[model samples]
Target: SVLEGGTWAAGRRAAAERRPGGGPPLTILSDGTVF
Candidate 1:
């Protein structure tokens, strides 16, 4: 699961905490691979 405790989850948690809506802190590319 994406929620599993790992580097990805760590970063996700960081993003969630940084943003108001739990969204990424940066703008994602239209290609869907830049975030």
Candidate 2:
């Protein structure tokens, strides 16, 4: 999942830079159909 790789992949170079505690990105939107 992109979420796991981008914002939730701790200690992974493929992950995006985030806050110290793995805070979510500022802009994300989805209906009730996805995670």
Candidate 3:
């Protein structure tokens, strides 16, 4: 699932960057595209 994968990646990146709320987490629509 793109959403799950993206969100996981985003969380890792955010943690590495030390920015808990730096921006929105990645999301995916029914079309399997990030939104």
Candidate 4:
């Protein structure tokens, strides 16, 4: 069960890496509210 869970987690991480914009980017906000 633990091994299966680990494999699933690893697969998800690999898929995320393959995405075009896989992670957040640097940004600046003049106002405190982002919305």
Candidate closest to the true structure, highest TM-score: 4
lDDT to native, each model: 0.49, 0.36, 0.51, 0.47
Clashes of each: 0, 0, 0, 0
Better of 1 and 4 by TM-score: 4
The worst-scoring run of ten residues by lDDT in candidate 1 lies at 25-34
In model 3, which regions exceed 4 Å deviation? 19-35
Q: Which residue segments of model 1 deviate by more than 4 Å?
A: 1-5, 21-35
Candidates 3 and 4, the one with greater lDDT: 3
Task: Output the number of the lDDT-best candidate.
Answer: 3
Q: Enumerate residue pairs that collide in model 1.
A: none
lDDT ranking of the models: 3, 1, 4, 2
Residue 4 shift from truth in candidate 2, angstroms = 35
User: What TM-score fits each model?
Assistant: 0.43, 0.20, 0.47, 0.54
Candidates, ranked, TM-score: 4, 3, 1, 2
* lDDT by residue for model 4 (1-35), tens: 99988976875665555445633322212211122
> Could you give me the TM-score of model 2 versus the true structure?
0.20
